[model samples]
Target chain A: MSQLDQSGAVPAAAENAAPAVSLSGERVLRVIVPLVMLAALVGLWAWYVQAYNIPKYILPSPALVAQSLVNDWPILGAALLVTLKITFAALAIALVGGVVLAVLLVQSKWIELAISPYMVILQVTPIVAIAPLILIYAPSTQVALLVCAWIVAFFPVLSNTTQGLKSTDHNLLNLFELYGASPLQTLFLLKLPAALPYFLAGLRIAGGLALIAAVVAEFAAGSAGAGSGLAFRLLESQYRLNIPRLFAALLLLCATGVAIYGATSLISHLMLRRWHESAIRREN
Target chain B: MSSAVSMNAVAPSGKPIVRLEHVSKTFSNGTIALKDMSLTIGEGEFVSLLGPSGCGKSTALRIMAGLGDASTGRVEWPTMPHDASGKPEREIGFVFQEPTLMPWATVYKNVWLPLRLHGVSKAAARERVMSALEMVGLDKFADSYPRELSGGMKMRVSIARALVTRPRVLLMDEPFAALDEITRQKLNDDLLRLWEQFGWTVVFVTHSVFESVYLSSRIVVMAARPGRVIDEMEVDAPHPRGVAFRTSLEYGEFCRRASQSLLSAIGANDHL
Candidate 1:
């Protein structure tokens, strides 16, 4: 009687453990749902423009925007290349600078106390507010725009990496000490590896911010030439009242931002999939 | 109290590995973690610093490991080889209460850490790392990360990491305290086996009386509230202690006496 009761009790938990939906079905729903929503939104937009017979200058139709994108490909494409160059250059510099600064700051309390306040001051002040000063001092408009993007993107990396360095496991530190590890060894082998997840997290956030800052700084600089970025084309298109070209440029910027985010997320996932909680897949 | 029970055989017959003489540690905030705690761990001895929480047993173990220094008195390692800097070489390995494995690293890499720090190349240290993992029965899980393993397996990885250096002195601060009873017992047996095979002088810090009795040839019972040693007792039972020893009448008697000592140590703090 007791054995039968025990056997009967096991099935409730077993039933609860079973997943409600198949894994593949759930995965298919995730991808399909978003594409469906996007299609519906685009269809509504196209219908609304057609019904109103809106002027191209006021609000370009999806077909007109697509046509403009094809017609203005040379100009807009070159501008995109310029903007991407500035964004990536600034981000690379920021990664190196932020990580080095964080490592130096963590080395001594006094160094951190003296320097961290300045970093905070820089972070809190608006980038546009400082863009004019940067433009005046910089040798070229490209350098000025790069500086602005770097200033915006670097703070998160510095702060997050600093936090990661400081939060290293105390026992592990002691273990390193017990092993008679040198300071450089501790920094590279212990602290750096421990701080990787935080650095990657900061990088993901900074990726989007870098692109935004690059465009905003260009808007502030308002420098117009063949070497000008997408921001300049947007301004030029607006001034000419070529709203279709402006919409096409705007669409390109949105795609670039999404691409940057997706790339950063993929990097973070690939780096951390083996160990980090956020990246690892759970059984259920 | 009985013929089998010996009074304070604190120092074993072998040469001393490390000695803490009148060591006391007070933090900057003025809390005395340890007070006048003097103990000597001889070579090839398994000594458990048995006490309740806040008793400075872990503090004492840390001092022994040279992770922290005593505010007063001194810790001496008389027999160990010294490095070029006139300090003792990395002759000691420590296992913390937690597994403390590098989460990002594979089991093979985590176990490889101590040797890597000592400037040993991967190719050179590979054999020893594998052997250490084999000792802990986790050789098959070498490529797995700490997150992938069970609690016991992670602890085993930690043990393997500590052993990779092949240190003469092994210091553990309640290393198995978080494990389930079955896992803990299994680890206890594995640890004893390693100690016997390696002849390592182990200073194990634990709060459990039963655990202290089971593992240690000598048990140092300590009191908290300023953290001082109150009693020392030796378990005269023979080694290769396993399930039969765990359930034996002799083991029960040792546990009973150790429990009494621990209770009175706690009782003494209550009186204060």
Candidate 2:
């Protein structure tokens, strides 16, 4: 083969047609289109509000929303930080709990039989229904809200991780056993690594839901006096008929959710980029 | 079982290294995968388990590898060496029907798995892994993932992983059945070269007449429906069997006889 290569026997055509990864003009347009559309929508909303002489109370123009955002930066910023803290903390707890439960469930059939039904039940029961009850009995409002957010985030991680652990290639497991690998070796070397994509997928979903649950729990608790999160700001704006601030708060919430998703997705991509098919960049 | 040995037919290089004594395997699903199968593989001999799809060829190979237990009888591995310290012990190397690589890992890591499982660190096992890859002519692809390789290349990596342990016994279950004819022929040649270099006992499973004839020094013909060995044929061919040997009249003669035995075994199995 080396001789053939030196003699130029390998045809250039036989070389694989790998996808070009450079950001060419066509690639730039894919990113540009979404930004252009978003600008157009905002531009149109501003024009419509002005042309129709709409009252600010009913629907504020995009300019007014921006102004509200600028003027209320301190309050909204604090609320944003609070919500972010709750979201990430709840997500961290959920991740640890879910993976632990999933590992235990996979370790034994009896544990899965004993607890899987309850997991399904926990998933089925909407967090909103029990947020108020949790708030009333819990020692502190923040702890109650954290518990609510955790409850919302935990199920997806548990279920996806469990499925991923169970989905390890049977032949690989047999090979491990043939080499006399202990149970712990199989779990750490085979099962957990295999579960990574599933766990990341669950984290992405849980990221969004944790934010939603935090806000929902704040609304249910009605405990807003200085240390509340973005959801409380949203509720306060709505009750006080502060339409522009409401839109501004909603805008921040949406942006935060998108940012959280982007971060998690970026993490997933970076970790799996080497081998997983999902993270691999391919030709269009 | 030792007294009933059939060394009468084999022209193997050495004494029996592995002997299956009245081995029968009945799966929990009530399927009799193998019944009363007996065969002996000599050291440094290239043996093929050739039969139809559902025959117990694969089952027999798995039993020999200690991956599956026989419900009745036993497999005697009298020549399997055991030493104290056992730090670098090389037992049996297995290649399944599929490549069975850990897709999440690179080729180096995949090939490094058996050693890794045996408590050998990656840094310590790197030299062995690289040499094994070089043996299969895939040393350059060590950093590449299994998903990036062609079907034949992936199978080579699988073989490289199997060779990484430097085992005394090699068990392959139809390892080339998925490849194209040209690729299969190329792998057969490469495998023959490796076998000659290493001189390990090989129990290869396959369903192809020409492949079995071209590769094995001895071919064990098996059948389904209570899968069992029905006949065994000695290739009586020289070492380093090349493409010329594959096309020779002697090769054709052995294939014809093996094909007849396989057919008759299957026909007889249908009744039992």
Candidate 3:
């Protein structure tokens, strides 16, 4: 029997009035409200700079920050590229390593028990404390930053994917058993596909975390040779008392974080749109 | 009726198809699912294991299919012309209560499962798959996914999958229990037609008294709590049973008698 009601309009009406009430409208509000708030904050800053007649060194105006961004475009852009390179490299490593660890964890209980405690310890430990030690032990600062970021991003994917792989439907599992499918066949066909939603969710979270870890690690472990990332630029600008340049660098970092979140979410949506409820919710 | 036909009676080609002797199953959880169950389904007999929920009817079917172990029994079968004696026979096909069609696979591929498992080439199995789909009247919907179909259509695909293997015996576990009254009756008729067409013996498990009465040549009534067969009834109704047969006075009387027997087998405490 069909579960669809006679009046198709009723479900739609309920959906509109209930949880999705503000969801779509709130997305527009989210963008509009934040932009309005940013404008007001900038307006207040500009007024304060002129009213109090504060020096540019103390608190630069938004215009001054824009000018500083233009003036140091070449150097700052290079540093931005460096940070992006490290972030992406670390993310790639984390993705591969995390999935392998998750697969191992699923395959053997002993390995999961032995390694899980260390993974937790790695996650909880501060990056600042480990960066210098990694820098000293590792050959280069770039490698050290990559390792730190990998450590930060690895756990979420590993934990999420492991749980997803194990969360297959019992009825479906019995069906597979009835067919006389081998363990490996079941894992590849059923477990892997079932785990995809969770893995994508974890990847989205890890994308932002990986970027944060890259920046944080650079702050602790000094940048070598070609002048490191946005974090180094931030610290240098602060030391030089270049307020406008510091604000511009901070803006870039925030933009990078937002981009990572948006891009990963898009990837997740594209991959899961056909079968998953999460993607279906977004469709309406 | 007193002819004393050989328990291992040879088919027209001189071969006994399936034999089960003293089959019983006790789950590791200590539930006695079946007790001293023995039945030899001939070439094309439609035998229904009519029982209540916990009567081990399904368990008995599974044991015949080799999907589960009989804690204490032996099942023997003559090696078909295509099979070697050294190799285990894989001719039995099973249809579960829930249409266990693969959600990911299309109807065509789902029906092709048994053949694929035996390493049969897809190209060679294509005709057989289509024929099986045709039998279920679902050949047109072969490319459709299980989720795209109705409950009745999905169950039809499940039956098609079982039939595709050209299995000698079909073991069904309440295959029509999930469908509506109309759909269930239609499927029951369709199932018997398939059984007759292929000349395949069916060991059907069902809770419905009317269903067993309508489709079975012989009905084995079972009782729960260490489930065992309590009574056996042989329906003398002729083959090619039509829709009108279900509404006939004889069919209703048979159903009533079967229901009474089932109620008594369930014990005096339980109400229908």
- Considering chain A alone, report the TM-score of candidate 3 relative to the true chain A: 0.88
Q: What's the TM for model 3? A: 0.82
Q: Kindly list the per-residue Cα lDDT of model 1 for residues A55-99, writing each as its tens digit.
A: 889988888999999999999999999999999999999999999
Question: What lDDT tens digits, residue by residue, belong to model 2 across residues A85-120?
Answer: 888899999999999999999999999999999989
lDDT of model 2 at position B174:
95
Q: What share of the true interface contacts does candidate 1 keep?
A: 0.57
Best prediction by DockQ:
2
Once model 3 is optimally superposed onto the true structure by TM-score, how far is the C-alpha of residue B18 displaced, in angstroms? 3.5
Point out the worst 10-residue segment of candidate 2 chain B by lDDT. Answer: B1-10
Task: Give the Å error, residue B174, model 2.
Answer: 0.7
**lDDT of predicted model 1:** 0.88
The lowest-lDDT stretch of 10 consecutive residues in candidate 1 chain A is: A1-10
**What C-alpha lDDT does candidate 2 achieve relative to the native structure?**
0.85
- Error (Å) of candidate 1 at residue B59 is 0.8
State the RMSD for candidate 1.
4.8
With a 3 Å backbone cut-off (N, CA, C), the pairs that clash in candidate 1 are none
Clashing pairs in 3: none
- DockQ of candidate model 1: 0.38
Which segments of model 2 are wrong by more than 4 Å? A1-18, A21-23, A281-283, B1-13, B81-89, B269-272
